[model samples]
Each structure stands twice: as structure tokens, then as C-alpha cells.
Target: MVVKIIVSTDKRAVKEENGDFGFILWEILIVVFLMGIILTLATPHFGSATNQVWIRIDSANRARIEGAVQLYRIDVGVYPLSVTDLVRAPNGMSEWAGPYLDEIPINPFDNAQVYQIGTMGQVK
Candidate 1:
């Protein structure tokens, strides 16, 4: 499909001899350069935004894990021996009301690690 735009040349645009009008090369280049500069300025802010999102997700995951642990404890009369118990039934265990959690929450910052079990049952 072909669409034609008719414009007379102002300062920013150039026309062919046939008088088709749009941005000149330098004007387009300037826009692209300005966009590049804006992107460079905004890149750090975008990175921090991503970190903030991950932090929120991490905190929510930690809370979900903590809640699951609590429910597991209430049901089984003890804290889980490990986070894996949250996702899989422990061997030969009865009164195991779970797979309480779908999966163990991994540390968001370091994917290889599970959230650390810090002092006082805190997920670090």
C-alpha cells in the first residue's frame, strides 16, 4: 500500500524534486541522536526500576514462603526440616497436609540460592 503525504518544506524537512515531503536526513539524525541521549540518561533509572520490581517480588515471595511455613508448622506440629518439604511430601510422612507451597522460593538476587534461613526463622 502506498500513502502520499504532501508538505511544503519548512526548516526541518526537505522535499524531493517531485515535492514529496518529510524529514531531511540531518533532522532525522538529530532526532535519533536526541533519543539516544535521552535513553542514555534514562538507562540508570530503568535499571533501578527493575531492581525495585525484583525487590518487591523478592519480598512477596519471602512472605509467601513464611506463611506457608507457618501453615505447615500448624498442621504438622513442627517447623519443616527443609524448604523442599514445602513442595514435596517428606518420605513416609503422614499428617503431611502438603505440598504446602508449589515450590521453594529462590533468592531473587542470586538464582542459585534459596532464600536464606536467617536467625529467628527469618528469610534473608
Candidate 2:
């Protein structure tokens, strides 16, 4: 089989040079840089939100523990002598509340440590 094809280009086409491929790469680089800047601006806001959520969770746990202790005191007429006292069984005249809390609440900062127990009274 034989085939023939003809191609033609005008003088104007020869004078016109296409734009550089680098222009497209530069546009892409510009878009990436803008995204980086936007993310950098938003990072602190994300951190603040995370801290606020953690603090709210800590405060909620503290309030729950305090309420439970108050109930125990109302029933027994005194705050448990110490943190350990809340976990053990209660006996006579001691006027106790068994397991003041369903379970010991953990310190948010350090889950291994139990939340601190303080004296039952108002602050002056």
C-alpha cells in the first residue's frame, strides 16, 4: 500500500513562538506556596481549639468527682479522710459511704495519677 500526505505552515506561524512550559510550572509553584501560607495561618487556631477541648474535658471530670464526693459526705457526714479511703469498704461509727465514686477519676494531665482530694470547705 502507498500513501502520501502534505503539511503546510504559514510565515506568520513561524514568527509565533509558543509560550514556555516553565510558565505552567511557575503557576503550579505559586498555587502550592499560597496553600502553604494558608495552612500556616490556620495552624495556631487549630492548636487553640485542641487546648480548649482538653481543658473542658478536664473541668467536666473535676466537677463529676466533686459532686460524687459531696454526695458521699452528705450520706456519711464527713469527707473521706484521704483519697485511699474512698476506695475501701466502710464500717461502723465511721459513718462511711462505700466507693464514693464509681471509680477513681484520673488526672487529665497524667492519667496514671488519681485526681487530688482536698478538704471539704469553702474558700475565704
Candidate 3:
């Protein structure tokens, strides 16, 4: 007596039997590389937008400080000699009505608490 055996040549059947059903390492690496490129392209725009927001905030703070100084002058009849004069009354001035600001704001760029008073009551 004699026996015969046959084998199936289908690629899908072979793959299923071997359990090879996931991405290769090279494919994953390629995806990661593409994502890095996309992020590199987008990073500059995000940085510029953040800078613009900081600029606007600094301008608004300057305006508020200037306004407070103007109010101080209006009440006391002389411009403040320094930004601190807005918060504290100088000697011999009875018209001081405030701690004009809750706290002095710091410069965003330099992290300095100092301010320069320009001509015509502008804060720099």
C-alpha cells in the first residue's frame, strides 16, 4: 500500500499560519521620521505667534502704567519722579489716593522690574 500528501501554495494561508500580521520596524521608523519633519516645519510659526502675544501683553501693561501715572499727576499736580511714586506717595504730597497698582509688573523680555519714564508721560 502507498499514501500521498498535498500542500497548499497560497501566500495568505502561509502568512496566517505564521502569524505575521503587524508593521515591520522599518515602516514604523519611516512614520516617526515623517512626523519629526512635520513638527520641525510647524515649530517656527508657533514661536512667532507666541512672541506676538507677548508683545501685545507688554504694550497693554505699559499703557496701564502710563495711565496710572497720569492719574497720579492729575491728583497731585506733578508727574511722578519714578514708577514707585504711583504706589507710594512722595514726601510732602498730600494728594496721593492710592496704591495705584496692586503690584508692579515686570518686563517680559528682561524680567526687570525697572521702567523708564520717557517725555510726555510715556512708560518705556
Please say which candidate is ahead in lDDT: 1 or 2: 1
TM-score of 1: 0.65
Which lDDT tens digits does candidate 1 get at residues 1-124? 9886657655434445446857669888999999999999999999999899989989999888788888877888877767787889898779799888887777778899776554345566
Local accuracy of candidate 2 as per-residue lDDT tens digits, 1-124: 9764334464334344343223356778999999999999999999999888878877887787777678677877877655555666555536665676667656656678666667872110
Q: Would you list the C-alpha lDDT of every candidate in the order shown?
A: 0.79, 0.66, 0.81
lDDT of 3 by residue, 1-124 (tens): 7764337776555666679756668889999999999999999999999899889888988998999888887888777888888877788878898777777777777785577777678897
Off by over 4 Å in 1: 1-36
Clash number for each model? 0, 0, 0
Task: State which candidate, 1 or 3, has the greater lDDT.
Answer: 3
Candidate 2 at residue 122, lDDT? 16
Indicate the residue-level lDDT of 47 in model 3: 97
Instruction: Find the number of clashing residue pairs for candidate 2.
Output: 0
The residue-level lDDT of candidate 2 at 25 comes to: 67
